[model samples]
Each structure stands twice: as C-alpha cells, then as structure tokens.
Target chain A: MSNISLSAIFAETAEPCLATPEMNRATIFFLIVTVVGLSCGVLAFIFGHHTIYNNTREMPWGMLISTYAFWAITSTGLCMYAAMSHVFGGTRMGMISNRMVWMSIICIMGAFATIGVEIASPHRMLLYNIISPNPLSNIWWMGTLYGLAVGCMIIEFAGIVTGLGKLALVMGVFGALAEVLANSCLGGVFATLPARPYWYGAQLPIYFLTSAFLSGAAAAVLFNYLAYRIRNEKMSTTVHLAVKSAGKAMTLVLILYSVATFWRLVSFYVGGPELGRTAADALITGPLALNFWVLEVGIGLIIPIVLIILSRLENMSMLAFAGFLILVGQFVARYDLVVAGQNVPQNLGWDNLPTHFSYVPSFFEFGVIAGSIGVVAFGFLMGERVFGKTFTQKEHH
Target chain B: MNIEDLEKEKNEGIGSLPLQERREFLKMGLALTGVFLGGSILSMTSISHASNQKNADMDIPSEGQYPYPKHYGMIMRQNRCVGCELCVEACKQSNHVPNDHGAWRTAIQEKITRENSTEKREFRPVLCNQCNRPPCVRVCPTKATYKDPETGIVVMDYKKCIGCKTCMAACPYNARYFNEEKYAIDKCNFCIDTRLAEGKKETACAAACPARVRIFGDLKDKSTEIYRLLHTPDSKIWVLRPDTGALPNVFYMNA
Candidate 1:
C-alpha cells in the first residue's frame, strides 16, 4: 500500500514503452474479434446448450473438448518451458522465460474458458473438487493441478515484475511441476479407460508430455518473433539464439512424437483387438486418412521438421512459419485424437452400428475456438505493454 | 382430457371469451399440462400398468451398514428372444427415458447371418452390465457414479453427476446416456431405485418379457434362478465385450 511499493509495480527502466498507430489498430481488431467470439460463447449459455452444440448422447465430447485439450496442453508446454529456463538461470531460454510465463498463464485461461462452457456445472467442479476429492479420477487431478499451476504462475509473474527473482524462481519451479503433472493427468483422463481400447495405454502419459515439449518449443519461437516484429526492432543476438534453440528442440521432439505415432498405429494392426484395429484403420485408410496422413503426420510433424532443416535454423520468418504450421497440425491432431478414439462403436457386430459417429463442429464451436485464440492474443499484447523493457533486456549465465 | 367437451367448447366460446380466445386458452392449457405430465407419465407409465409382482411388499428400511444380503444379476436366453423388443419398451417407461433423445438404457440388436437356417435372426438384449470393476465408476471424478455396496450394482447419484459423460466413454457396452431432462448420465441400475426400492424383486424389463427370456435373481442366493443358471456347467454362458474386462454381472446364454 506504500507509495514506493505501488510505484515498484512498474519496472523502473530507461527503455520507452510505445506502440505504433498500426499496432493500436491491430489491438482494436483483435479486441473486436475476441468480443464477437465471446458473444457467441455467451449465446450458448443464454439460449441453451443443446441448441447451439451439436453434441449428442452418442458423441458427448465435441470440438469444444478438443479445443480445451489443445489450449490446456499448449499452456502446459509454455509453463514447463518457462520453469526450465528460469529455474536453471543463465540460459537463453531463461532470458525469455518471463514472456513464456505470461503466455502460459494466458493460454491456460483460454483452456479454462473453453471447458467452462463444455462442463454443465463448472462452479460445482470448483467447490466440490476441494470438498469431495477423488484421487482415483484422472480428471480430478487434471483440474486441481491446472488450477494450482495457474495460481502459482500469476504470483511468479508478479514477483518477476517486482524484481523479486528468487521468489519468482521458486514459484516458477512449483508452477512447472504442477503443469507437468497436470499435463500427464490430462493424458490419463483418456488413457486410463480400459473400455476405450484405442486410448488405453501406459505410454500416453509420456506421449502427452512429449507433445507439450513440441508445442511449447514451437510457441517460444513463434511468439518471440512476433513480439520483436511488433516493436519494429532488429533481433538481438541473445534472443535469436533463444529462437533457434527452440527450433532445434522442436525438430527433435517432432521426430520422436512421429515415431511414437507410427508405433501406436503399427501395434494396433499387429495382433491388437478387433475393435481397436478397426479404430486404427479409420485413421490409416478410412475416414480420418486425410487428417492423419496430411495434417497430423505430414504438416504437423514432417513439414515443420523439413522447414527447420532447410532454413538451417537461420531464418526467423521461416522458423516462425514452421512454428505456425506445427500449431495448425497440433489443433487438427487433438481433434482427430478425441474424435477417432470414440468413433468406433463398442459393439462391432451389432446391426446398424455406425462405423464412426459424425461430428462436424457448428459455428458456435468455432466461436469458442475464436474466443480462445482471442484470449491468447489479448494476453500477449498486455504482456508486451507491461513487461516490454524486461523482455528486451538480456540475462546471462 | 375430454374429447367431446373439447368439441363442444370449440363450437361455443366459454364465459365471455370469443371463439379465437377460447381456442388459444385450450392450446396454452394443453401445452402446460403436456410439459407437466410428460415426465411423470414416463416414470409412472410402467409402474402403474405393468403386471404386479406376486411377492408381498417388503418394507425394508435403511441401515448404516450394507442392507441387501445379495448381488442381483440377470441371465438372458438369447435364442429365446423373438425380437419383440417389449423389454426395451418396459425399460424406457420404467426409467422415464425421453423418446427424442436418440438414446436408450436397453436395446435389442438383431444379428442375422444367412449361413444359419433356423438361427438366422437372433435378438441380443444389451443393457448396462453393472461390471464388478466398472470403468464408469473408476473414471468418475466426483464418484458421481458408484457401485452399490449392497446390490453390487453400478448406480448413479443423480445429484452428484456433472453430465461430463466421461462414464459414457468409459462404458464399453454403450449403455450410458445423458438425460437432458434430469441433466445427468442415465444408465441401467437393474431398476434398483425404481422397482427394487419399491419392494419389487426384478426389473420391469425382466418382468415384461413375455417369452421368459430374461431370468433375474440374486447372485448370492443359492435358490435364485440366476444363481442356478450360472452354477450350471451344461449351459454355455458369456458376457458382451469380454475384451473390455468390465467383469459384467449381465450374462448372455446361447452365445
């Protein structure tokens, strides 16, 4: 409450905090789009849930759940990345950890918002999750830990702004741990099911963690490039190294995750259960062939790896482009994973059984996606304004 | 309610209202009553009209510990099913399931293979297996759905369910449905709450099947029909989707 403490909220650095008119226009545009999408999300609550959403008894989880997983997983990646850089300190990743911390908080907020609409009673989840804890449920852990990560990140970011590096570092470590555990639990939510054979596995916890690394590394490069470009400043050597460093990690994880994906398919065909193989077949040569072969496998993994290699990790624009493609592929990949897992009916021999339950996300679903994107964009712009100077300064080992 | 009275009312306006006003009044009244009666009718239809249980009413009250000395189960003679689907109808009425939801608590799937002559068409009545190790119970975050300690039935606490439908995905039988009316996940609990809670020994579906295809009784009771059926080594018995490892209480004969 003191004058010095209040004033200390703003970093006392000589660097100017300024945005061009074009930047102002861009912010306004983002704000408009966000508001429009938010209104659509609100409309689902206002009119009725069943009215807007195309989800049925057959396919309970629709695109909204997929979008939630997409954002939540991305947020986990960001937080983990931040924790690694700052906790170790004296690394290029550490220098950019502040930005990553801020975005991680924002991205999780987007994830929460999407799932907020998806769950029928989110308020009860908040209250009862504490009062009536179920250690057995993976979903319970996912929700509770994500909530913990978000809280810790907020305090850690505040500590960073206040020049309390030690406090921030400690909180960053806990926040990172929570995010990683929560990320694995998120995977366990699907992977723990014995009934859903496609999702049932011991490897998913590790697989999902690998995905987080890939998404997080790519995000670090893309957002960092965008941040510098918006400032109309040349890339600093330290920041360039940070961006390229992310590129290298991304290349490695993309290859590993792709191998995991390959084995996941191959294992199904080789003496896997009948229904499980049928589900796998849908991904290989059936309805989801395009999403798997083109977007998830080719564009998401291979293309980005190719681009990073061809650019020799030098071109910022190319790295960012690859990052963008990686993100697009992740989005589609999450959708296909969720949809494909449940597409095959439990009874294969039953008469009139649908090969796959059709789920084409309506515009309301798109609104939720747009709204989630808006959340990240708004938070990113705000972070630039608040911590612009801090992000520009370089920290060394 | 009275068709002849409605005809007379349409011909002559009631009280001081005009002909058009009277018609609107009737429409509004009918809509209100329809909404009000729709749910009650669904719940009460089978309870009121079905053939009554021969056993005297058992006025059993609650205890702190487990109440029932048995775990109830069903054995369906699959070949005996004539594909009448009356069991499906009885289940819907007993559970108060909505017709337009495109979901059912129980259903009959016909398996017609041309290779077999007499056994060409066979109806398989599939319901919630009430697994000993229920995936629905395990995956529920709030313990919203759980196993009944007394009956060993996988029952749902309607109050606790968040309608996440995680249980639906976890159930390999495809037995769970989200009730838009109750705003909860609906599944077969062997009509434990509806029939058994009210002193009936068997589910409405088991009772309603005229061909006696379904034999329902306590698995723990040696004298019960279901117990005898399972104890017999001569008859071949199987559960649906054994690969799921649900360990279902519902067994199918003639598989």
Candidate 2:
C-alpha cells in the first residue's frame, strides 16, 4: 500500500456505467422533467416577471426565493458536513464524504437554476457581481463566495473521479470554507434588512449554519440509500456504518435546531419591533399557521427527532422516511420565514389590509420550484449511473 | 420530557434584559395569542403610528446643512393634502411612468372613514424617502441604486439594475416599483433625471400640488423653505417609519 504508484490509484478508482434499461429510463425521466420545468422559467423570463409571477407591490418575494434558499442551504450543509469530516480526517463520516461532495455540487446547481429564473437580469448578474461589486452588501458576498465554492467543488469532484486524492482533498477543504462563509452571508442577506425587522439580527446566520447540518445529514442518508436501492445491491458493512453515523448526527442537529427555532419566536414576542412581532404572529396564528405548526414544528422538527430515535440508527426505511419529513419541514420552514417577514403590510395600518398582506405563487413560480427539484433528482440519478462504484470506494485512514 | 430534563438547559438564556422569561412562557403555547391582542398590536398599524411620538416629533436640524452640501428632500404638509390625487397623475406624465401594474414615481394613500354624516379622507402621498442612510443603496449588490453625491438624492442607474428587487424589499416605504418598460427599478428620484436636471426648481409632484401638500427644496440652502421649516420651533416634524433608522431626508408636518 505504501509503494502504490499514482497511476495505479487512478486505475483503481473508476467511473461506473448504467448497465440496465431501468437505470437508463430513470435518468432520462429526471432529465425530461428538469427540462420541462426549466422551460417554464425561460418562458416567464421572456415575458416580464410581473406578467407571469403573482408577486405584487405589497409582497415582492414569494415561493421561488424560499425554494432557492432551501436548496442552497442544503448544498451548504452537505458541503460543510463532508468538508468537516474529510478535511479534519477524524470523523467516521469521511467514509461517505465523496458522495456528499457530488450532491452538494448538484444541490447548488439546483439553487442557481431557481434564482436564474427569479432574477430578471441574470446576464447582468454574472457581469456586475465581478466588475461593480458592492463591498457593503451581504448579497454580494453571498453570490461571489457561492460562485467560488461551486468552482472549487466541481474541480474537487473531478479530481476525486480521476483518483487524485491530494488535489481532491485540497480543493475540498477550500470549497467547504467558501460554502460556510457564503452560507453565513446568505443568512446575513436576510438578517441585515432594516425593513423586515422579523428577519433582522445575528441569530439567522448562526441558525442557518446549524440547520444546514440537519438538512445535510438527511440528504446524505436519503440519497445514499436511494443510490444503493437502484442497483438492487446489499449495503456493505462500512457504508452502513457511515449512514448510521449520519442518522445520529441528524438527530442531534434536529433537536438543536428545534430549540433555536423556539427561542427565535420567544424573543420576537419579548422585545422585537412591532412590525417584527406581527410577522411572527403571522406564522404563529395567522395565514401560515398550518404550515408552521403542522409542517415546520411538527413534521420538520418533532417527527424527525422522534423517528430517528425510534429507528435506533439501523432501519433504512425508517431513516429514509425521517429524512423525507425533515426535508419537507425544512422546505416549508423556509417558505414561512420568507413570507412572514413580508406578510405584514409595508404601510402597516394605512394600507387598509383586513389582515397581514398575502401572496400565493403563480403557476410559473411553482414550475421554477419543481424545476429546482428536478435538477436535484436528475443530478443524483446520473451520479448514481456515472459514479456508482466511485461512491463505494471508501477511504479509511 | 421530565422536569429534570427541562432544568438542564439552564445556560441557554442569552438576552440580558428583564423581559418576561419567554422560554418558559412559550412552553405554555398561549403567549403568542396574548401578545398579539395586547396594546403592542397597535404599534404594528401605521408607518406613522408605529414610531414613538416623541421620536417622531424630533426637533429640526440646527447644524445648518454643513453635513450635505446639497441635501435634497421634501416636507409633507399633511393638513393641506386633499385626496384629489392630481400629484400622482402629474408624476406619471413627468417621469414617463406607465399606468399599469401600479407603477408610479409617487402614490396617494387615502385612509377614509365615516365621520358623522360626512366621509372624511386623510391622504398621505408617499414617494421615495431618500434616506441619509439609505438601505436601498446599501443593499444594492451592483450599486444600481445610489445616493447622488452632488444632490443627496437616491438615484437609480437603470442600466446597472439587475431587477433583483432587494431594493424593493429593503425599502421601508415600498417606494420602488419594477418598470416593465425599462426592465429595471423605477422610483421617485426628486426628478433628478427628468425635471431637476432640466432646471426645474422642485419635483413634478411638488410643483403640481394645488393644496401645497409637498414642499421640496435644498436643505443645504438654509434660506430654502425646507431648512426654514425644520429650524422653526413648534415645527412638530415627523418622518415615516423612523424606527427603521434610515434617517430619511423627507420630513412630514401638519401646517
């Protein structure tokens, strides 16, 4: 092992091909779904954002922003978790860090797809983010650092595919650092808003990073289980241990995130701005009550925490279900957060609204979200086909 | 789930204020409902009502405009404003703002109710507040919206605007609207490009107001009406959503 040549290692770690008709069909299906959903966003872009999107002067943001946050945060979580395990080189979770690296890339791509549709001038975004950078803006740092992270992750993944461990490890560490910072900035983008007092403060950045772990672990477990199921192969013992370790991690983060969420609400009632308090009220008892209670708290937090405990880290089906629930809850949690901040009237008492302002995503907005999900599914299945065996190539130091 | 388990999170109380122990209160599940029904709910009502009256009635500038050489702003005389909405129309024509999608450089919000046998309407015309510490300018990643150093107006460089709407979301006044025709954000810029550059003394809205609702001028000129209005004792000056701390150049008064 000590005398092994670089060429020999490159020869050992090889990409897998789709050998069955069913595998080909699945990949093609996801590709078609992604293409169709993405086409709707393109059409909306060709028209005007106001023409297709249900967004109004009152509620400017809607579901697309929430969904974008969901995917982007998930990507950061996966990248951070993998980078932590791999770069630090101690946690047993490093066994599956390679697969996580691949997913993080795909998830960020999903985020980019949604935001690309949301922005009216995406072409300008690419140019202006570099030349005319606003150093004071959180959005600027989030965009720039996320772009850097994506570049690093892609190169690192390519290095991994070609069995260049040294190059992959170096890029992986840099990519993870960029992801954490970008992710914090993404939180800051919301937190720094003086207008939306509900979202204002330092808590969101920390909360966002903490929630990333919960989502990252769930996604890793769910995708890895699905990848193996596609091949109809039995799980190797070491890989099983890796998934179990992720489940434990998810359980712990889920509890912590739950506590963080509770305190955020409590703090709002205690001393937050009036407008901020109403925004919290909207989530607590107003229009978004069902989503907040049933989905975010009940399903996203409680059920996942309880299910992970009951499964005892062994049952694959139990773990997968908990992951699905956590993902669903986290998705709605984002929707509630974004919506609640804007739900209160900007004019407040003078706007003549019977209650907090309202917004429902137009058909195009839903299409954009579906498109983002399709990107995730499409990438994951293809990764299974192209790098199936590569994921199983465990590195234990 | 037990009392002992609950007691373990003793170190989690982070805030130093003597407010109610919200952590324990939250466990009861009724705290949210109670808080909303309380007096603080009224604090969520209006841009005007939400601000502390003492804070809103802040004394006008005494420093005599040394900070900004050309502090361009408007003073809304709320008592003089009628619900005619002529200013809203004049602004559209002057700025070339299209009528659809509620796109206007300025708007009149009429809060009306029945007073005895007559209907009383209170009209407040809202435009860009043009903050001294403008959140819109600060949040624009591309530097699309910026404070014009020459005049202290929050001006838009439409060519650079990517239509991200972060400015729209960040604005406390909801002053900005996406201009479909231009494919960029459009808002009241004190007529910087349209009229002011054309040698007009005041904004189109201020110029067209029959009731003399809007008073636009340069605060840098202490002789200008804006400075005089602010410097006057018993001025009773106010600004919209002052709690946001944007420190708007636009001030409101009732005389």
Candidate 3:
C-alpha cells in the first residue's frame, strides 16, 4: 500500500453518487440534530442527573442504559458479520463487508456517547478503570473489551482505507474476537446479578449473543438499502446479493431468537422464584405488556420473519422495510428487558410499596436517545461521502 | 371468640389505630414474634422460632469463625422499631443525606397485615448489610466500593466511582442511592468516618434510637452485645435474604 495523504483522500471523491447537493443537505440536517441531542446530554452534566433525570432511587437505570446496550449489541453483531465475511471471502456477504465494518464503528461510537452521558463520572471511569481496576467485575471486562475492539476496528478500517488488505484482515480478526467477548461480558453484567432474580442465571449471556446477531443482521440490510437509496443509484448485482444474504441471516436468527425468548419466559413461570415470576409478569401482563406483546413480540420477531418468507428474499424494498421494523422491535425489546428486570421491588412485602415500581424516561432522556440515532445517521452520511468508493468496490488481498 | 365470630368482625387496619393507642403499644415494647408466616413472607420475616429448622445456621457463619479481625455488625430488634424515625433523622444529619430527594442512609419499613379481623403492625429498620461478600463491591467496575480488609465493612471510594448504578442494581437490599452532591453512589457506611473515627463506639442511628433496638458491635468479639445476642440459645436470629448467599453481617432478632 502506498502512503496516502489525508488531503488526497478528501479530494479523491471518485464516487459521483455521494457528491450531490441533496446528500449534503441530508447530512447537514442530521448533523444539526446530533448537535442538539448532544447538547441535551451536556445539560444533564450541568443540572445533575438527580434533577434532570426521572430515574428514582428504586429505578436507578432509565432508557439511556437500554439504548446504550442496543447500540453496543448491534455493533458487536456487525463486527462479527464483517469479520466472518472477510475471512470467508467470495461469499455473497463479502461484497458489503467493508461497509459493515464502517457502520459497526459508527454504531459503537453512538453507544459510547450514550453511555458517556448516562454515567455521571465518565472521567473517573477512564482514570480509575485503569488504576483501580476490578478484574472480577463483569462491567469492567465489558468496558475494557469494547475499548480494545474499537481500537482494533479503527486501525482495521484505516488499513482498509489505505489499501493494507493483510493488516485489515488481521486487525479485523482481533476486533471480532474482542467484540464477541465484550458482548458476552455485557450479558454477564445482567446475568450475574443474583440480587435481580429476573436477570439472574446462565441463559442471559447466550440470549444477548443471539440478540447481537439479530440486531446485526437487521442493521446490515437496512444500512445497505439506505446506502443505495441515498445515492439515487441502482444497487449493483453484488450489493443486491449481499443484502439478500443478510436478509436470509436475519430470518434464521429471528427464528432462533423467538425460541430463545419463549423458553426464557417459560422458565420463569416453571418453579422459579416468585419474585422472578412477578418480574416476568411485568412484561406478560403488567405495565410493560403493551411494549412486550406489540413491539417486542409481534413487530420485532413474528412479523419480520413472515415478511421475509412472503418476499422470498427477492423483493429489496420489502426486505429493507422488514429490516427497519426489526430494528425498532429490537430497540423496544432492550427497553422491556431492562425495565422488567427491575420493576419488582427488592424488598417487596416488607415496605408499604407497590408490587411494581414505575419509571418514565424524562424529556432529556428521550433527547439523548434521539441524539444517539443522530450520531449514527450523521456518521452514515459522512461515511458514504468519504468512503463511498471503498464501500462500493470489491477488495482483494 | 369463635373462628366464625372472629371472621365476621370488621377488620381495623393500622390506619384506624389511635395515636394514644399506638403510644401505649410502644410503651409496652412487645417482643417481635418469631413465627414463620409461610414461605411467601420469608424474605420479609427472616426470624424463625422453629427448633427443627436446619437452614437457620446458613444465615451466619459458625461461631468463632469470622473472616475479619473486627466483623462489625448490627442487630435490629425489629419489634422495638415504632417508626418514630429519630434514627433516620440522625443518619441524615451524620451522613449529609439530603431529605428532599428521598436520599436515605437508613429507613424504616412498616408492614401491616390483617388476620381474623385483627390488625397487626410491625416496623423494621434497614441499612447496608455490610455483607461478607457484598454484591455492590463485586459489580463495581472500578473497585469504587470495596470491603475494608481490616473491618470487613463495605466502604466507598467516591473518587473512583463512575456512577454507573450497576452497583445499585446488584445490591439485594436496595441500600444504595446516587449522591448528587458527591457525584457518586452512597450508602450506609456504618458511620465509619462520621462517629467511629471520632472514637465513638456506636453509629449515629444506633446512638439516637430510644428503644435500644439498634445494637452495633464487632461480632468477632464474643463479649460484644451483637455476638452474644446472635448466639443466645434458641434465639430466633436471622438475616434478610440469606438465599442470596451474601452472608450479611447485619442480624435481626428479638434479644
């Protein structure tokens, strides 16, 4: 690979599709939203989380935590897919693997930004997480692994951009491994909490990994569709085949995830702790019933699988639309899983407390969630503009 | 009264208890009942008077086998707590906990149940258990909350805390809260820096309590009231949520 200057990379806008004024306007719009959303996050720092957030002593984690998890899981899924496609070169999915790598990086940054604000002392986290490390902590491992994955992915992306194919593949392998381990650690954070019966046990780590693949596959189809649509260009035969392959992966994972989800809920009712049953009931029959039944179950799982079957993986628009709905469902699924686990009080019968605690995310919390979406949106547009050629062309080592 | 007549009578809840009558009950100082009210209520009521109970010894370690040089603990005579909240007030003052935000280092839990047209009320005080294996310490990403090697007391290093609230979720007792002023999670530190560092023997809440319900001492020391109270023959000694396997130092009894 030759030495490529930053100026040369910026000036070399070889792709005609991304040079349009319309694409520029869309990018600017997302940029403005990103600024507004991030400013809302900054407001929490100034006002203090206690005043700005609706999170109570009972429900300490709100919607932001779920959003962070959703984005992180998606990123992990994307990273793994990209690495697999690269390793198994000449597969239909390999055609769009480079684009997947780019989107994965963007999604992880979005995750970081959301969590950076959700936590009160991000600076302390950086400092003490290094100096006062706790090897036993699942959260500690998650943070460290994600950090390593990001570093590897960024270097890998650089290698891809600079035409260092061998370096890219090596770093991609490490990035994928880090991401997979990080994803499991994320699940461990919830699964190992014996205090929270709803989240306890060994099922959650595998459950989260399954979810990562689901979200990853959905994001692949959606982003690929958007890439073509944004450019007002027709999809190449290779790109079409790659998206179709992603659709097939999405359908398969959807079925597996549905089974996993069913058993997860069933296990709670069959001889589990009463507290755990009540927690599951929070989604099955209580306050979160609407979110669970409609968004998580009907929209996120069943409908998407049916749509894919109807389309027979041939209709591009149908596949993309189904992918969009799947993403929405997955988002709501994360929220339901987080909220339901904490709904039942720890000391339920002791205090004169309600059977289930109520938590409503504040306006600022929504703003931060929107801001994370904006980050991904803006990054997608910029990536298309800058790395348009790299994404569209087939790579060779 | 016959069972039919008792069932037919109107059940008066704690809401109907007169102020004078409540005061009289407090003066009487009834010992907490050790009756096990079924398996459903085991999480709320830990003490069991049953002599044949095999699980009673599981809540605590065997006698004279402590993990720390000074295994500090507290025993709450749950029945003596009348919900006066003097201890809560004292905790707030000592710990600098803000009242407006519902930030509490310790609090009272009032349980009212009706059985056969009779209303029964019980007040239970809760604080950080200072578990031998604290979940908060286990989940804290930065070792912000750690068990003091010397005292086995779970303490916080606020400067290292990231305020992730993972520790809060991991705590089985719901004993933690985010301290906005400190920009970190805070909980009952057993007044380590407040009174104990000042050459005092007891915590602020224990000292403020009028009913002598809060007993604070080193459980490793056989002479201390905490150790004696927990070891008394046939005493109904228990700790909350022993199934969590936290091996909490805090004891609840009717000593």
Best-matching candidate per TM-score:
3
**Least accurate stretch of 10 residues (summed lDDT) in model 2 chain A?**
A9-18
lDDT score, candidate 2, position A10: 46
lDDT of 3 by residue, A120-213 (tens): 9899998999999999999999999999999999999988888889989999999999999999999999999888888999999999999999
Give the clashing pairs for model 2: A349-B45
Q: TM-score order of candidates, best first? A: 3, 2, 1
Q: Provide TM-scores for the models.
A: 0.86, 0.89, 0.91
On TM-score, who's better, 1 or 3? 3
Residue A16, candidate 2: C-alpha displacement in angstroms:
4.9
* lDDT leader: 3
Q: For candidate 2, what is the TM-score?
A: 0.89
User: Alpha-carbon error at A193 in model 3, in Å?
Assistant: 0.4
Give a tens-digit lDDT track for model 1, residues A126-211: 66677766789888889889999999999887777666777788888899999999999999999998777788889878888888
Task: After superposing candidate 3 on the true structure, give the runs of residues whose Cα lies further than 4 Å from its correct spot.
Answer: A11-14, B1-52
| Chain A TM-score for predicted structure 1 | 0.95
Query: Model 2, stretches more than 4 Å misplaced?
Result: A1-18, B1-61, B64-66, B113-120
Query: DockQ numbers for every candidate?
Result: 0.36, 0.50, 0.55
Candidate 2 vs candidate 3: the DockQ winner is 3
